[model samples]
Structure formats: structure tokens, C-alpha cells
Target: MKTQVCIIGGGPSGLMLSQLLHLKGIDTVVLEKRSREYVLSRIRAGVLEHGFAELMREAQCGERMDREGEIHEGFYIAHDGVLDRVDLHKYSGGSSVVVYGQTELTRDLYEARDKMNGVVIHNAEDVTPHDLTSDKPYVTYRKGDEVIRIDCDFVIGADGFHGVSRKSIPRDAITEYEKVYPFGWLGVLSRTKPVSPELIYAKHPRGFALCSLRSQVLSRYYIQVPLTDTVEDWSDDAFWAELKRRLPEEVSARLETGPSIEKSIAPLRSFVAEPMRYGNLFLAGDAAHIVPPTGARGLNSAASDIYYLYHAMVDHYINGSDEGLENYSAKALARVWKAQRFSWWMTTLLHTFPDRIPYDQKLQQTDLEYLFSSEKALGSLAENYVGLPF
Candidate 1:
């Protein structure tokens, strides 16, 4: 089989890319290694930057999100036993973020793809791309005992960090930069009302915690933990108790505790791969870069990569211009580094490092105090939190 483009993933990035390309009269095929059920079961970040929302609208997939997602204009930060709010709308030129779960967004994209009769093969095994540098590029995978080959003019690797796409790049051609934090985030999803009207990021002597929500009725919360800790190490009661201990007394007093519907521990890290394109094969989304979720950039950043790639491919095919395609790497990486810097800065500003000495702690406190005291500092945080321009 042959097509204009072969997308090697069925996640939001690949699906959205396929949907956009279809609107441009471009034919594409998508491959997924996991079952559709497994793909939708994974939970992820919910915050959507304004540009992402607009993209969803363009894909004709934003009706559900616009109807159900919450618009958050600001968030709170608890430090030194007090709660302070950062006005995102005030600092972001009236821009606000939408709180829509990644699961729902993926579902919407899937529905849109189905309505358009887009081709997506699931449960593909041993997926691999070949002859990337050659004029002709093809991808192969197995279904049971049969081998299927798809020849295409372009291969898109939206399969994520663990997928074969990024790894397929020759080691010498890729320069990888990564920083793994010594701790992880312990997150819980429950059906209780959130403790605050908006998300609250708390910094205490014990650790850092965030109070967030997927909807008015579905609450999501997290607390920083050591790398050695596991979900089994903390029961529901223990997790609630610890979360309350770190929150401001007033907020804690109003907190409602309940059994967690889901609990997991996620390691935090910042990683980026240079030169997103390698000959006929291109990387997008998690396949190219990953940021810590502190600033809610993990998925939004992926959306930006898609934005650049979709436009680039369109320009090349329709306008007879190769400039966008040639510049995809430099353009995407420029935004990628800015987001990495923001996420790293937020993580350092809010999280307590176990290895920090007394002086370091004092410095952290001073930074927090300065942030709250200076309008300029708060404005900077708000601008980044609402997201930078694409």
C-alpha cells in the first residue's frame, strides 16, 4: 500500500496531523502498536493553551471541549502558610487556558477521524521505518504472522519517546539532552469537588503539591515524592493526610477526602532531541521533546510541533515551497527550548530539593517572597503559564 504520508502513532499528535492533512486533500495512514482501549485508558495533562484550542477548532474537534472544558483565568500558589493568586488573564493579554482532559481530546480526535474515514491500523507489531535517507521511504510492521509494508513520500514518527521513530535516527546524527529529576510526582484522581475554585500549587517545608481538576466534579491532585517511593508505599488515607499537611490551613480545612479512583507515580524529566527531521522521516510531539508537567506544557508543546509540521507539509505540497519543511527543525526547537526553560524554572521555584543545603533553602524562600512581592515577576510567570506564542 502507498500514501503521501505514514503516521506511526495513533495518539493525539498523529491523529490531529492526519485530520489536518485530510482537510488539505492529503492521504495518510496511521499505525498504533496498542489496542484502542489501551490507548484511551492512559491519563495525562489537561491544560490547553489558547493556540491549541484554536487548532482543535480547526480540526472540527473542539465542540465537546468547548462545551465541557473549564476556562481558568488564574491559579493560586501556597507558600509561607499563605495563598497567593497569579492572574493569567491580566498578564496574558486576556488569554486563558482550557482544562480539558487529554483522554477526552484524544477521543474527540478519533471520532473526527472516523467521520472522515481516515485509515488507522491498531495492534501493529514490530513497526519500523526504512531507507529514510533514500528518495523512496517505507514503513513495515507485523499483524500476527503477516508482514505489511506501506510506502510513502514522508514518514512521521509521532510514536513518542519510547517508540522506534526517535531511536531510528542514527546516534551520530542526533544530539540528545536530558535531565532526570531525583524525585517523582505522586498523583491521584478522585470524584470529589476540588478544594479551590482554581488550581493551587503549594510549596511547603515537606514538599510541593498541586491541586487541579479535569472538571467541576473530577479532581486531580499531586504531591512531590522521592524517587524511591512507589504507589504501594502510600495508601489513600496516607496520601490525603500528606496532601493536607502541605496545604495552607484554611485550604486544608475545607478539603474533602475520598477514595482515589486512580493512583500512580510519574518521574519528572526534561528531554529534547536535536534536528527533528532526518531525511524523509520527521519526528513530532513526544518523539522530539518532553518537558516537566509543572507548567502544563507536555501536551501543549506537542501541539506546537504539530502546528509547525502541518503548515510546513502543506506549504511544500500546495504552494510549491520547501522553506517551511526545511525550517521545521529550527522553528520547532526554538519554541521547544523556551518551554524547557519555563518548566525547569517553575520546577526549581516550587519544589524542595533534598540535596539542597541551608543556604539554598533560604534562597528558595527569598525567590518566592520576591515573586509575590513584585508585579513584574508575577506577570512573567502568568505569561509563561498561559503559554508562549506559536
Candidate 2:
């Protein structure tokens, strides 16, 4: 098979890119290692930055999101038993985030792709990209016993962190930066009404806790835990107890409890691979960078990458310009670094480090106190939380 672009990975980023390019009359193909059912089954962050929400609309995949996704104008932050609200709508020039699960977003993108009859091959194995440094590039993968090769002008590595896309780049050419946290987030999804009207991020003397929701009736909550903790170690009752302890009294008083439908622990890490491009192979999303989930920037950052790459492709194909394509790495990394900064700062502010000295704790407390006391500090958090410009 031959195409203008071959996208390795059918996740939201790759699929979204393909759909956008398809609308522009650009021919492309998608390669996925997993079945469609498996991809849709994975649960992920639901918070959508303003720009990403707009991108979904532009992709013609926003009908369901617009109708069902909740719009959050503000979120609460609790420390020292005090709850403070960050007014994102007020501080962000009327911009707000949409709460729509990543799973649902992928479903919408997949539906649109099917309707358009876009080429997306599932269960593709041993995917590899060759001649990426040359003007002409191609991708190959095995499906069952047959080997399929796709010749394309460009290859997009959206296969994520563990995938082969980034690995394909020469080790000496890419500089990697990473910091793995000592703790993890133990989260539980339950079928119960959320305790608060908005999400609450609490930093208690014990640990950090987050109260988020998928819908009014579907509550998703998390609390910081030791890396040694396992899902088997946490029962529904014990998880609820721990969550309530970390939350403010008033907020915890209204909390509803139920059997957890889904439970898991996710480690926190901040990682970035410099120069998100090598030859005709461009990296997007998790394949290029990863942020700790504290700032909810993982998926949003990926959306920014999609924006840059899509415009670059359009410029190259339609306007006959190579500038966008040439500058893709430098431009994408500039924003990626800013996001990394924000996520790292937020993680430091909210999480309790092991062997943390008293002075550090005081500083963390002082920072929260300053944020609540100063409108400027709150504004900065609001602006970054809603998302910076694309």
C-alpha cells in the first residue's frame, strides 16, 4: 500500500490527525497493534483543555462531546482544612475546560473515521519504519503470517512511550530527560454522585487527594499512595476512608460511597525527548513527552502537538511550504517544556515527598497560603490549568 502519510498508532492523537488530514483531501493510513475493543476499553483522563475541545469540534467529532461533556468553570483546592476555589472562567478570559473521558473522545473519533471509511488497520504487529532520513519513507508490520508494507511520504510516530516510534530514532541524536516519582496515585471509579459541584484537589497532612468526575453520577477519586501499594491492598471501604481523611470536613461530609467499578495505581513521572522529529518521522503525544498527571496536561499537550503537525502538513501539502514541517520539533518542544514546568510545579505543590524535611513542608504550606491570599497567584494557576495558547 502507498499513501501520503502513515500514522503508527490509532490512539486519539493519531486518529485525530488522520481525520483532520482526511478532511483536507490528504490520503493517510493508520496502524494499530490492538483491537478496536481493547483501545476503547482503556480509561484515561477526562479533562479537555479549551484548545483541544475546539480541535475536536473542528474534526467533526464534537457532536456528542458538546451535548454530553460537562463544562467546568472552576475547581477547588483544599489545604490546612481550608477550601479555596480557582475561578478558571474569570481568570482565563471566559475559557473553561470540558470534562469528557478520553475513552469517549476516542469512540467519537473512531465513529467519524468509520463513517468516512478511513484506512485504519487493527492488530498490526512488529510495526517498523524505514528510510525515515530519506525523502521517501515507508512502514512495515506483520498481520498474522503476512508482512504488509506501506510506502508513504511521511511517517508519524504516535505509538506512545513504549512503542517503537521513538526507539527508531538514534540514541545519540535524542536527549532524554525523566524523573520518576516515588509515589503513585491509587484511583477508584464508582457509580455515585460526586461530592462536590467541582473538582477538588486537596493537600492534607497525610497525603494528596483528588475528587474528579466523569458525570454527575460517575465519580472518579484518587489519593497518593506508596509505590508498594497495590489494587489488591485497597478495598472499597478502605479507599473511601482514606479519601475522606484527606478531604476537608465539609466536603467529605457530603461524599457518597459505592463499590468501585474500576481501580488502579498510576506512577507519576515527568519525561521529555528533545527534538520531536527525525527526518520524515515526526513524533506526537506520549511518543515525544510525558508529564506527571498533576496538571492534567498529558492529553492536552498531545493535542497541541497534533495542532502543530496538522497545520504543518496542511501548509506543506496545500500552500507548498516546508517551513512548518522543518520547525516542527523546535516549536513543539517549546510548548512541551512549558507544560512540563507547569506539571512539575503542580506536583511539587500538592504531593508529599518521602523523607520530606520540615522546612520543605512549611514552604509548600506557605505557597498554598500565598495562592489563596493573592489573586495574582490564583490567576496564574487558573490560566495554566485552563491551558496556555496553542
Highest lDDT scorer: 2
TM-score of each: 0.99, 0.99
For candidate 1, write residues 287-374 as lDDT tens digits: 9998889999999999999999899889988998989889999999999999999999899989989899999898888998899889
Pairs that clash in candidate 1: none
Model 2 residue-pair collision total: 0
Clashes per prediction? 0, 0
Q: After superposition, how far is residue 61 of candidate 1 from its true place, in Å?
A: 0.4
Candidate 2 Cα lDDT to native: 0.95
Q: What residue runs in model 1 are displaced by over 4 Å at the alpha carbon? A: none
| Reference-based lDDT, residue 265, model 1 | 97
Q: Poorest 10 consecutive residues of model 1 by lDDT?
A: 378-387
